[model samples]
Target: MKAEQKFMMIFRFTPNFKYQPTEAEMVQMQEQWGGFIGNIAIQEKLISTYQLGFEGKQIAADLSVSEGILISENKTLGGNMVVKANSLEEATTMAKDCPILKMGGTVEIRTITPMGN
Candidate 1:
Protein backbone atom coordinates (compact mmCIF):
# COMPACT_ATOMS: atom_id res chain seq x y z
CA MET A 1 0.00 0.00 0.00
CA LYS A 2 1.18 3.49 -0.74
CA ALA A 3 1.87 5.78 2.17
CA GLU A 4 -0.40 8.76 2.41
CA GLN A 5 1.08 12.23 2.77
CA LYS A 6 -0.53 15.33 4.13
CA PHE A 7 -1.28 18.35 1.94
CA MET A 8 -2.42 21.78 2.96
CA MET A 9 -4.77 23.65 0.65
CA ILE A 10 -4.57 27.37 1.25
CA PHE A 11 -7.30 29.60 -0.08
CA ARG A 12 -6.77 33.26 -0.92
CA PHE A 13 -8.65 36.12 -2.50
CA THR A 14 -8.01 39.72 -3.44
CA PRO A 15 -8.52 42.09 -0.55
CA ASN A 16 -10.35 44.59 -2.70
CA PHE A 17 -12.63 41.92 -4.09
CA LYS A 18 -15.07 43.26 -6.68
CA TYR A 19 -18.49 42.00 -7.75
CA GLN A 20 -20.17 40.93 -4.59
CA PRO A 21 -22.53 38.07 -5.37
CA THR A 22 -26.17 38.09 -4.41
CA GLU A 23 -27.55 36.25 -1.40
CA ALA A 24 -28.44 33.24 -3.55
CA GLU A 25 -24.97 33.10 -4.99
CA MET A 26 -23.45 33.25 -1.54
CA VAL A 27 -25.62 30.36 -0.42
CA GLN A 28 -24.65 28.33 -3.43
CA MET A 29 -20.98 28.92 -2.75
CA GLN A 30 -21.41 27.90 0.87
CA GLU A 31 -23.12 24.71 -0.23
CA GLN A 32 -20.37 24.00 -2.71
CA TRP A 33 -17.73 24.31 0.00
CA GLY A 34 -19.70 21.98 2.23
CA GLY A 35 -20.03 19.41 -0.51
CA PHE A 36 -16.38 19.59 -1.40
CA ILE A 37 -15.23 19.07 2.17
CA GLY A 38 -17.91 16.50 2.78
CA ASN A 39 -16.70 14.40 -0.15
CA ILE A 40 -13.17 14.44 1.22
CA ALA A 41 -14.36 13.47 4.64
CA ILE A 42 -16.29 10.58 3.18
CA GLN A 43 -13.20 9.42 1.35
CA GLU A 44 -11.26 9.52 4.64
CA LYS A 45 -8.82 12.05 3.23
CA LEU A 46 -9.67 15.11 5.29
CA ILE A 47 -7.30 15.76 8.14
CA SER A 48 -8.41 19.18 9.32
CA THR A 49 -9.71 22.55 8.17
CA TYR A 50 -9.86 26.14 9.34
CA GLN A 51 -11.52 29.41 8.43
CA LEU A 52 -9.23 32.42 8.89
CA GLY A 53 -10.74 35.51 10.35
CA PHE A 54 -10.02 39.04 9.12
CA GLU A 55 -8.85 40.21 12.54
CA GLY A 56 -5.33 39.14 13.32
CA LYS A 57 -2.01 40.41 14.72
CA GLN A 58 1.29 40.16 12.93
CA ILE A 59 4.77 39.96 14.41
CA ALA A 60 7.24 41.80 12.26
CA ALA A 61 10.85 40.88 11.67
CA ASP A 62 11.85 43.23 14.45
CA LEU A 63 9.41 41.45 16.79
CA SER A 64 7.04 44.37 16.65
CA VAL A 65 3.54 42.95 16.65
CA SER A 66 0.90 44.87 14.74
CA GLU A 67 -2.85 44.46 14.90
CA GLY A 68 -5.14 43.69 11.94
CA ILE A 69 -4.67 41.42 8.94
CA LEU A 70 -1.15 42.54 8.20
CA ILE A 71 -0.43 41.20 4.73
CA SER A 72 -0.35 42.24 1.11
CA GLU A 73 -2.64 41.19 -1.75
CA ASN A 74 -1.13 37.72 -1.46
CA LYS A 75 -1.38 37.78 2.30
CA THR A 76 -5.10 37.44 2.54
CA LEU A 77 -4.63 33.82 3.71
CA GLY A 78 -8.33 33.20 3.87
CA GLY A 79 -8.78 29.52 4.80
CA ASN A 80 -7.16 26.12 4.52
CA MET A 81 -7.75 22.38 4.55
CA VAL A 82 -5.45 19.50 5.36
CA VAL A 83 -5.87 16.22 3.50
CA LYS A 84 -4.02 12.99 3.03
CA ALA A 85 -3.04 11.77 -0.42
CA ASN A 86 -0.60 9.36 -2.01
CA SER A 87 1.16 12.00 -4.10
CA LEU A 88 1.14 15.64 -5.06
CA GLU A 89 -0.60 14.85 -8.31
CA GLU A 90 -3.38 13.04 -6.55
CA ALA A 91 -3.77 15.87 -4.07
CA THR A 92 -3.86 18.42 -6.85
CA THR A 93 -6.42 16.43 -8.77
CA MET A 94 -8.66 16.52 -5.74
CA ALA A 95 -8.19 20.27 -5.36
CA LYS A 96 -9.27 20.92 -8.93
CA ASP A 97 -12.89 21.00 -7.86
CA CYS A 98 -12.32 23.68 -5.25
CA PRO A 99 -15.16 26.21 -5.19
CA ILE A 100 -12.77 29.02 -4.37
CA LEU A 101 -11.46 28.94 -7.91
CA LYS A 102 -14.97 29.44 -9.22
CA MET A 103 -15.22 32.58 -7.10
CA GLY A 104 -12.05 34.08 -8.56
CA GLY A 105 -10.01 32.91 -5.59
CA THR A 106 -6.86 30.79 -5.56
CA VAL A 107 -5.95 27.48 -4.02
CA GLU A 108 -2.35 26.84 -3.08
CA ILE A 109 -1.44 23.23 -2.42
CA ARG A 110 1.60 22.40 -0.35
CA THR A 111 2.86 19.04 0.78
CA ILE A 112 3.43 18.70 4.52
CA THR A 113 6.81 17.23 5.17
CA PRO A 114 7.06 15.42 8.45
CA MET A 115 9.60 16.59 10.98
CA GLY A 116 12.82 14.74 11.77
CA ASN A 117 13.17 13.62 8.20
Candidate 2:
Protein backbone atom coordinates (compact mmCIF):
# COMPACT_ATOMS: atom_id res chain seq x y z
CA MET A 1 0.00 0.00 0.00
CA LYS A 2 1.19 3.49 -0.80
CA ALA A 3 2.00 5.72 2.10
CA GLU A 4 -0.70 8.22 2.90
CA GLN A 5 0.21 11.88 2.77
CA LYS A 6 -1.58 14.87 4.14
CA PHE A 7 -3.17 17.36 1.75
CA MET A 8 -5.16 20.52 2.09
CA MET A 9 -8.23 21.38 0.09
CA ILE A 10 -8.68 25.11 -0.25
CA PHE A 11 -12.17 26.22 -1.25
CA ARG A 12 -12.74 29.55 -2.91
CA PHE A 13 -15.85 31.18 -4.30
CA THR A 14 -17.21 34.46 -5.55
CA PRO A 15 -18.86 36.58 -2.91
CA ASN A 16 -22.22 38.25 -3.43
CA PHE A 17 -23.11 40.54 -0.59
CA LYS A 18 -26.31 41.71 -2.25
CA TYR A 19 -27.97 38.33 -2.57
CA GLN A 20 -28.92 35.96 0.23
CA PRO A 21 -29.86 32.34 0.11
CA THR A 22 -33.27 31.34 1.45
CA GLU A 23 -33.73 29.13 4.50
CA ALA A 24 -34.46 26.11 2.35
CA GLU A 25 -31.37 26.73 0.30
CA MET A 26 -29.33 27.00 3.45
CA VAL A 27 -30.66 23.65 4.67
CA GLN A 28 -29.92 22.04 1.33
CA MET A 29 -26.39 23.37 1.38
CA GLN A 30 -25.91 22.01 4.87
CA GLU A 31 -26.97 18.59 3.72
CA GLN A 32 -24.72 18.66 0.70
CA TRP A 33 -21.72 19.66 2.74
CA GLY A 34 -22.54 17.09 5.35
CA GLY A 35 -22.74 14.30 2.82
CA PHE A 36 -19.51 15.29 1.17
CA ILE A 37 -17.60 15.41 4.42
CA GLY A 38 -19.23 12.25 5.65
CA ASN A 39 -18.01 10.30 2.64
CA ILE A 40 -14.42 11.26 3.31
CA ALA A 41 -14.79 10.62 6.98
CA ILE A 42 -16.07 7.13 6.23
CA GLN A 43 -12.83 6.43 4.42
CA GLU A 44 -10.88 7.68 7.43
CA LYS A 45 -9.05 10.16 5.23
CA LEU A 46 -10.45 13.34 6.71
CA ILE A 47 -8.19 15.16 9.13
CA SER A 48 -9.90 18.46 9.76
CA THR A 49 -12.07 21.12 8.10
CA TYR A 50 -12.92 24.75 8.63
CA GLN A 51 -15.45 27.29 7.38
CA LEU A 52 -14.31 30.89 7.07
CA GLY A 53 -16.50 33.70 8.25
CA PHE A 54 -16.96 36.65 5.96
CA GLU A 55 -15.46 39.07 8.46
CA GLY A 56 -11.66 39.18 8.73
CA LYS A 57 -8.61 41.38 8.97
CA GLN A 58 -5.65 41.66 6.62
CA ILE A 59 -2.13 42.68 7.52
CA ALA A 60 0.22 44.36 5.09
CA ALA A 61 3.91 43.81 4.67
CA ASP A 62 4.48 47.11 6.43
CA LEU A 63 2.67 45.71 9.49
CA SER A 64 -0.42 47.77 8.77
CA VAL A 65 -3.75 46.14 9.59
CA SER A 66 -6.79 46.41 7.32
CA GLU A 67 -10.39 45.50 7.86
CA GLY A 68 -12.21 42.86 5.82
CA ILE A 69 -10.99 39.73 4.06
CA LEU A 70 -9.16 39.94 0.79
CA ILE A 71 -11.13 38.95 -2.27
CA SER A 72 -8.74 38.79 -5.15
CA GLU A 73 -9.79 37.86 -8.68
CA ASN A 74 -13.42 38.15 -7.62
CA LYS A 75 -13.13 35.13 -5.32
CA THR A 76 -12.51 34.65 -1.62
CA LEU A 77 -11.53 31.60 0.36
CA GLY A 78 -14.62 29.97 1.83
CA GLY A 79 -13.11 27.09 3.78
CA ASN A 80 -10.61 24.27 3.73
CA MET A 81 -10.33 20.58 4.50
CA VAL A 82 -7.30 18.50 5.33
CA VAL A 83 -7.18 14.90 4.23
CA LYS A 84 -4.82 11.96 3.86
CA ALA A 85 -4.22 10.38 0.48
CA ASN A 86 -1.67 8.30 -1.30
CA SER A 87 -0.80 11.10 -3.67
CA LEU A 88 -1.83 14.46 -5.00
CA GLU A 89 -3.91 12.79 -7.65
CA GLU A 90 -5.72 10.76 -5.05
CA ALA A 91 -6.40 13.86 -3.01
CA THR A 92 -7.65 15.66 -6.12
CA THR A 93 -10.04 12.84 -6.77
CA MET A 94 -11.42 13.20 -3.26
CA ALA A 95 -11.82 16.93 -3.65
CA LYS A 96 -13.74 16.46 -6.87
CA ASP A 97 -16.91 15.79 -4.93
CA CYS A 98 -16.68 18.94 -2.82
CA PRO A 99 -20.01 20.79 -2.62
CA ILE A 100 -18.37 24.10 -3.32
CA LEU A 101 -17.61 23.18 -6.93
CA LYS A 102 -21.29 22.89 -7.78
CA MET A 103 -21.80 26.36 -6.36
CA GLY A 104 -19.39 27.88 -8.91
CA GLY A 105 -16.49 27.63 -6.54
CA THR A 106 -13.00 26.21 -6.96
CA VAL A 107 -11.07 23.69 -4.90
CA GLU A 108 -7.32 23.65 -4.71
CA ILE A 109 -5.45 20.59 -3.49
CA ARG A 110 -1.99 21.03 -2.08
CA THR A 111 0.37 18.79 -0.20
CA ILE A 112 0.78 19.56 3.47
CA THR A 113 4.33 20.59 4.29
CA PRO A 114 5.75 21.01 7.74
CA MET A 115 7.88 23.91 8.87
CA GLY A 116 11.59 23.76 8.22
CA ASN A 117 14.19 25.01 10.64
Candidate 3:
Protein backbone atom coordinates (compact mmCIF):
# COMPACT_ATOMS: atom_id res chain seq x y z
CA MET A 1 0.00 0.00 0.00
CA LYS A 2 1.18 3.53 -0.68
CA ALA A 3 1.97 5.69 2.30
CA GLU A 4 -0.49 8.39 3.13
CA GLN A 5 0.23 12.07 2.39
CA LYS A 6 -0.76 15.01 4.55
CA PHE A 7 -3.39 17.43 3.33
CA MET A 8 -4.44 20.73 4.86
CA MET A 9 -8.10 21.66 4.75
CA ILE A 10 -8.45 25.40 5.12
CA PHE A 11 -11.83 26.57 6.33
CA ARG A 12 -13.31 29.95 5.49
CA PHE A 13 -16.58 31.71 6.16
CA THR A 14 -18.20 35.09 5.99
CA PRO A 15 -18.42 36.72 9.39
CA ASN A 16 -21.69 37.85 10.95
CA PHE A 17 -20.28 39.96 13.74
CA LYS A 18 -23.66 41.27 14.82
CA TYR A 19 -25.11 37.82 15.36
CA GLN A 20 -24.63 35.93 18.60
CA PRO A 21 -25.61 32.29 18.88
CA THR A 22 -27.71 31.18 21.83
CA GLU A 23 -26.36 28.84 24.49
CA ALA A 24 -28.27 25.91 23.07
CA GLU A 25 -27.14 26.70 19.59
CA MET A 26 -23.55 26.89 20.76
CA VAL A 27 -23.86 23.47 22.33
CA GLN A 28 -25.32 22.04 19.16
CA MET A 29 -22.50 23.50 17.12
CA GLN A 30 -19.92 22.07 19.52
CA GLU A 31 -21.52 18.66 19.15
CA GLN A 32 -21.47 18.89 15.40
CA TRP A 33 -17.81 19.87 15.30
CA GLY A 34 -16.96 17.21 17.86
CA GLY A 35 -18.64 14.52 15.81
CA PHE A 36 -16.91 15.67 12.65
CA ILE A 37 -13.43 15.59 14.16
CA GLY A 38 -14.20 12.44 16.12
CA ASN A 39 -15.11 10.60 12.97
CA ILE A 40 -11.75 11.43 11.38
CA ALA A 41 -9.90 10.65 14.59
CA ILE A 42 -11.52 7.23 14.77
CA GLN A 43 -10.00 6.43 11.40
CA GLU A 44 -6.59 7.65 12.62
CA LYS A 45 -6.43 10.08 9.74
CA LEU A 46 -6.59 13.34 11.69
CA ILE A 47 -3.27 15.06 12.26
CA SER A 48 -4.36 18.34 13.80
CA THR A 49 -6.92 21.15 13.65
CA TYR A 50 -7.29 24.77 14.69
CA GLN A 51 -9.88 27.51 15.01
CA LEU A 52 -8.71 31.07 14.35
CA GLY A 53 -9.58 33.93 16.61
CA PHE A 54 -11.29 37.06 15.42
CA GLU A 55 -8.70 39.45 16.72
CA GLY A 56 -5.59 39.69 14.56
CA LYS A 57 -2.98 42.08 13.25
CA GLN A 58 -1.76 42.31 9.70
CA ILE A 59 1.53 43.85 8.60
CA ALA A 60 1.97 45.53 5.26
CA ALA A 61 4.99 45.76 2.97
CA ASP A 62 6.01 48.98 4.72
CA LEU A 63 5.84 47.16 8.09
CA SER A 64 2.74 49.04 9.14
CA VAL A 65 0.36 46.99 11.28
CA SER A 66 -3.41 46.90 11.05
CA GLU A 67 -5.90 45.38 13.44
CA GLY A 68 -8.72 42.88 12.82
CA ILE A 69 -8.96 39.81 10.62
CA LEU A 70 -8.62 39.90 6.87
CA ILE A 71 -11.70 39.15 4.82
CA SER A 72 -11.57 38.85 1.07
CA GLU A 73 -14.50 38.24 -1.22
CA ASN A 74 -16.63 38.31 1.97
CA LYS A 75 -14.85 35.30 3.42
CA THR A 76 -12.32 34.96 6.25
CA LEU A 77 -10.38 31.91 7.34
CA GLY A 78 -12.16 30.28 10.26
CA GLY A 79 -10.07 27.22 10.86
CA ASN A 80 -8.10 24.37 9.28
CA MET A 81 -7.35 20.69 9.63
CA VAL A 82 -4.44 18.51 8.65
CA VAL A 83 -5.11 14.88 7.82
CA LYS A 84 -3.42 11.90 6.28
CA ALA A 85 -4.97 10.59 3.08
CA ASN A 86 -3.96 8.58 0.03
CA SER A 87 -5.16 11.31 -2.30
CA LEU A 88 -6.87 14.69 -2.42
CA GLU A 89 -10.13 12.94 -3.35
CA GLU A 90 -10.09 10.95 -0.11
CA ALA A 91 -9.36 14.06 1.94
CA THR A 92 -12.18 15.85 0.17
CA THR A 93 -14.52 12.99 0.97
CA MET A 94 -13.61 13.37 4.62
CA ALA A 95 -14.24 17.12 4.53
CA LYS A 96 -17.71 16.58 3.08
CA ASP A 97 -18.94 16.02 6.64
CA CYS A 98 -17.64 19.39 7.83
CA PRO A 99 -20.27 21.47 9.60
CA ILE A 100 -18.96 24.68 8.07
CA LEU A 101 -20.40 23.68 4.70
CA LYS A 102 -23.85 23.72 6.25
CA MET A 103 -23.22 27.32 7.28
CA GLY A 104 -22.18 28.37 3.79
CA GLY A 105 -18.47 28.08 4.43
CA THR A 106 -15.76 26.47 2.30
CA VAL A 107 -13.00 23.93 2.78
CA GLU A 108 -9.98 24.08 0.55
CA ILE A 109 -7.71 21.05 0.48
CA ARG A 110 -4.01 21.38 -0.37
CA THR A 111 -1.17 18.88 -0.23
CA ILE A 112 1.47 19.50 2.43
CA THR A 113 5.01 19.93 1.23
CA PRO A 114 8.32 20.29 3.08
CA MET A 115 10.53 23.36 2.96
CA GLY A 116 13.98 23.14 1.47
CA ASN A 117 16.89 22.56 3.82
Model 2, 47-100: lDDT tens digits are 999999999899999999999999999999999999999999999999999999
**Candidate 1 residues 48-83, lDDT tens each?**
999888888889889999888856766477799999
Task: List per-prediction Cα lDDT, in the order shown.
Answer: 0.88, 0.97, 0.97
TM-score of 1: 0.86
Cα error, candidate 1, residue 68 (Å): 1.4
lDDT, residue 64, model 3: 98
Candidate 2 residue-wise lDDT at 100 = 96
Per-model C-alpha RMSD: 2.3, 1.0, 0.8
Error of 3 at 9 (Å): 0.4
Those runs of model 2 whose alpha carbons end farther than 4 Å from true positions after fitting are none
Error of 1 at 19 (Å): 6.8
The 10-residue segment of model 1 with minimum total lDDT is 69-78
**Alpha-carbon lDDT of model 1:** 0.88
Candidate 3 per-residue lDDT, tens place, 15-111, comes to 9999999999999999999999999999999999999999999999999999988999999999999999999999999999999999999999999
